[model samples]
Structures are given as structure tokens and as C-alpha cells.
Target: MRLPRPGEPRRQFVKRFLLLAAYSRVLTADWNGTLLAEIKPPKRPTFGMMRLRLSDFPALQNDFGSVRIGTSALTANNPLGLLYPILINRATQGQFYALLSECTHAGCAVRPYSKESGACVCPCHGSRYAIDGRRTAGPAFFPLLQYPIQFDGINTLSIELPDLPHEIEGSLVRTLPGAEFRLQLRFLAFAHLEYEVVFRASKTDDWRNVQFSLTPEAPLNRSFVSGADDYLNLYVEPAAGLGFFAVTIRILPV
Candidate 1:
């Protein structure tokens, strides 16, 4: 499949890419706040990702219909920390639902709404989601983004995620209480290209840019800190040639 050339606007690139992916449709947003397209999953959906070991979570063991929230265990030093306060629930024997604990409507973190109902409800607006992250109620019309799961018969449960963003806007980004942070970049090798990691402490903060080139000698990864809030954006320079990359960012606790 073809990818957007380097330097293309991120939203535009994602739009075109989503069109090309109509057959394997990835949910995305348009400016008017509408779904670009929808496709049925051919089977249980899955993606490549950093694995989180379930063995580390004893609270989830053998507890059917149980829901709990915890960090993805990705610290400032762990690129996979991009996903945090992950919601894990045991639906049945050998079955689990692991999803990002963020509201699909306004980027607010959601919490367990009701154990009996098996939903994660957003505190800001009352968007309710099922254990599988299906939006059972609105304010949030879209379902929650979930991580792929791989359970080893005995003691290891691995949460799988793509190196890329699940949804362009912060769907894969996690906000932790902190002033320090890090971002790891994994892109298709394009030695001549330069990329920028832009960010702000909050909605009102000015954007800051951290630029770097992708070279064979070493990868472009960075650590950052902001005294106010946490947020980020990625951009590719030269915008004309074919290029692709995935990044994971994590905030260090203060």
C-alpha cells in the first residue's frame, strides 16, 4: 500500500491513507466531526504493538467480570508508555477486554461506570462504554480504541498495539501527572528525511518544535519536560517523498 509523501499535512495524509484503507478501514475523523468511513472487521481485529505482561497484574487473574485500571507500565523511559491508565476486564474464562481509558468525545479519561453494567463511563460528559469499548451511550459516538490481546495459556497476557498512532489525535497518547517526558520514533528508513516532534503543555500553550533527521547511525528519539501540561504532535519535513514512521511518547511522573 502507498503512504503519504513526507511533508504532507498530517490530517490530509491520514485522510488519504484512510481512503486507501477502505477495505481494511481504520476509524478516523473529519473536520466536521464525522466518521470518514466504516469497514467491518474481517475477524477479530489486531495490530502490532509493544506487549504488556499480564503476569505482572495479579489483580486480573481468574477474576471473571472484573475491571481494573492501571498504567501500561510504560515509564518515561518506555516508549510504549504512550498508553496509560489502561482498562482491563475479564469477561469470561480465558477472555479479556483491554482498552484505552479515554473518552471518544472530548479526550477525557473514563472510569468504570458500573460493574454490573460492564461499562467505562466518562466523568466529563457521561459517555458510557461497554467492556469491549463499544459506545453503549453518547456524548461519545465512537468506540474506545482497544489494544490487541495475546494470552499464553498459563501466566502471560500480552497487550498488543501498533507502533503508530491508532487515531491521529491523542487516542494513543496518555497524560500522566508530570513535567518530564520522552518520545521514541520508529519510521521506515529514509535517510534523507527530517522530522519534527512538536508539543505544548496545554491547550493554550504555544507549540514547540524538536527536529531531527533519520540516519543509519542512530535513531531520533528525545526527552522533554514542561512545567504546565502534556500534549504533542508530529510532522515530517520536505513533504514530497514517500515516508512513514511510528512514535510512542510517555510522561514522567512528577
Candidate 2:
């Protein structure tokens, strides 16, 4: 161990102090393989998560091809989307990499730069990363987070996700105006929350003011009646041109 020399610059002294602290932590901890300067805590439930299937991605069907954006439904409510986005790249046959779309620097969604380069570029601040999640350019120091992926050695694939409550997702196809849409939302037995499920006539349209509230008395199963109004009934066409609607769940603080 060596002491800092006298009359060190303030910035240099601060950097040296941080380096020593990190080194001390490394020394005290078990070294499995790779070392990290800082370890981020495990992701929480509110963060976006995905469960991707490999065959569903066309780019991965071939070897060493372009990156593809895969989306899967989130288990719970998140501002991002009902479907969580992930980046996938195939290195070779049966070898693939799955990375979160969020940039490590400013948390912007990273977009594919070029198929030949196998890199993702952040639009917010010019952060660049390889398909394997390593930071490749300036403006970002930490590597993008990677998730575990498993394949059945066939068409099916499963990606590990953060622990989230089981969600009722997808749509119900009905032809009747008074068709009832039912959703069964279950949370952790020990958890408590205020929730609302809102419906909208279209994917891009605003949700109707009629919203369902979760209550302690009967929070397990909830139902919504569609086409009860003239405005909604107008969308319930026989051709099914504009009848598509959406139900979104919003979790509120207790």
C-alpha cells in the first residue's frame, strides 16, 4: 500500500480516493470471474421486462445477421408500453444475445445502427454499444444490461424476467355490443395497492372516462361492458374496421 504524495491536485486526490475505496471492496469480496467497479442493485418490478421467443424474430433465423427489436407484454403497468422492447442479435447458429433496449447513459431506447456492424446507437446522446451489450463509444461507461435467454434447441425460446405479478393480457374477440370483457388481476398476497383499468376505443385514442377501480372487497376479478354508449357503439362495426379497443391497468399508490 502506498500513500498519496503531498500537494496532489484536488481532482486527482478525489479520483485516487474513489479508486482505493473500490479496490478495498473488491479485495473483501469473492472474485468469481469478471470484476466491476460498481454493482447496480437488482432491477425492481416496475422496470420493463420481456419474454422473447427466438423463432418469432426473423433476423435471428439466419446466422450473423441484422439486429431485431422484439417485444413482449409486460406483466404490469409501466409508462413505456404494454409491450416491453428488447434487442436481439444472432452471433451464430443457436447462439444469440438479448439486451435491454434502454441506453445505459441517459436511459433512451437504443436503436440499431447497422446490420453489418452489429451495434446499437443511442439517439439521445450518441452512446454506442455492441450487440453483446458492451459500451463501444463515448458518453457511456457502463455496459447495457443483458438478460438470460434459454432455448429448447428448437423453435421455442424463453427469456428470464424480473419477478412481476401475473398479468391478464391480450384481447377478447366478441361481436356483440354489450359484450363483457373480464380480467382477473392478482397481486402478491402481502401487497396492497390502488388500481384502475381504463378502456379506449382505439390503440392511439384516449381512454374513456369510465374506469374500473380495484377494491379490497372484490379486487380479484373485474369486468367491463363495451358499447354501452353511442360513441362506443359507433365503433362496434360489423366489418370490424374500428372496433379495436384496449384495456390498460394503472397501479396507484396506496
Give me the candidate number with maximum TM-score: 2
Question: Tens-digit lDDT track for model 1 on 75-171?
Answer: 2222123334456666666877777766789876666334555577777788888877889987888998887776676765555543322333211
TM-score of every model? 0.40, 0.43
Off by over 4 Å in 2: 1-52, 66-84, 163-166, 169-254
Please give the TM-score that candidate 2 achieves against the real structure: 0.43
Q: For all the candidates, what are their Cα RMSDs to the real structure?
A: 16.4, 22.4
lDDT by residue for model 2 (1-254), tens: 01123243323311100000000012224111111111122256443233344444455566554343322222222213332345665666577666776777867667643455557777778888876778999698898788786666777545554432232222222333555332222221211211233344454565443333243223334343322112111111111234222222222210
Q: Cα miss at 180, model 1 (Å)?
A: 30
Off by over 4 Å in 1: 1-48, 64-85, 112-117, 164-254
Model 1 lDDT at residue 110: 69
Candidate 2 residue 8 C-alpha distance from true site, Å = 74
